[model samples]
Target: MNVMPLGEKLLIKRIEAEGKTAGGIVLPDSAKEKPREGKIIAVGSGKLLKSGERAKFQVKKGERVLFSSYGGTEVKIDGEEYLLMSEDDILAVIE
Candidate 1:
C-alpha cells in the first residue's frame, strides 16, 4: 500500500527494536525500547514560507533519520507502527 502524507507532515515507518540483549539474552516485548530511528517512507510538500515560497525539507524517502524520543504522533498502518510528524521534529538524517 502506498501511503502519501499531506502538507508538511512526514510518514515514517518505525524500525523495530532488536529483541536480543547485549549479553545474548532474548528479551521480551516488554523489554524493548522505543525506536528512535526510522526510515522515511513518505514526505509532504514543503512548509509554506511567509513570502509564499515553499521551504522544502531536506529529508527524502528511504533516508534513515533520527527524531526526538517524545515527538510525533503514533500511528498504525497495515498492522505496523509508524510516526507522523513535522520536519522540525526530525533531529538528523542518519548517514
Candidate 2:
C-alpha cells in the first residue's frame, strides 16, 4: 500500500456489508449499516515504550479485525475507502 500508518496506527479496508439477512430478506441501501469489521492493510512499526524502546504491535497485516463502530478516521485512497485507527481501537481479531 502507498500509505503507511504511523506509530501503532493501522490501515484497514472495511469488509462489504451484507446484502441480505439470514431470513432471506434483501436489505435496502438505507437499511444497511456500516461494517465494523475489516482486514488489516498496513500497520505501523510499534508504539513507544517508557523504556526507550518500541513495543511491538499485536496485530499484523492481512488479519481480519473488528473495530469500534464509531472509531477511526475514514479516508479514501485511489477511490477506495479505508480506516485509519490506532491498535487500541481494534476490538478483536476474527479467528
Candidate 3:
C-alpha cells in the first residue's frame, strides 16, 4: 500500500468474479469473466484544471465502484493485483 496514484487516478482491487452458474454449475477459472466491479484502495488528490485549481474527486477510498471492463491498466503491487484508472473511467459507485 505504499504506492499512491497520481492526479485523477485511482488504485482499485477487482472484486472476485462469480464462480458458480445459476443452475448450480461450478465454473472454472478460465470460464469466469473478469469482474468489472472493485473496491477503491486509494485515490489521487484531484483533477488539475486549466484555472490552476484542483477539483475534488467524487469517489473516495473504500468505495465499491463499477468501471468498464477494458478501462484500467493492470498492475501488480508486491504480488497483489490492482487496477490504475482515471476517475472518468468509473461508471458508478455502488451504494
Worst 10 residues of 3 by lDDT: 1-10
- Please identify which of the two predictions, 1 or 2, would achieve the higher TM-score against the true structure: 2
Write one digit per residue (lDDT tens) for candidate 1, span 1-31: 5788887899998888899988999988997
Clashing pairs in 1: none
- In candidate 2, position 45 carries an lDDT of 80
The lDDT leader among the candidates is: 3
Which pairs of residues have clashing backbones in candidate 3?
none
Could you tell me the TM-score of candidate 1?
0.91
Per-residue lDDT for 85 in model 1?
95
**What C-alpha lDDT values do all the predictions have?**
0.90, 0.93, 0.95
What lDDT tens digits, residue by residue, belong to model 2 across residues 17-71?
Answer: 9999999999998999999999999999899999978889889999999999988
Misplaced by over 4 Å in model 2 are none
Give the 10-residue window scoring lowest on summed lDDT in candidate 2: 1-10
Better of 2 and 3 by TM-score: 3
Q: For model 1, what is the C-alpha lDDT against the true structure? A: 0.90
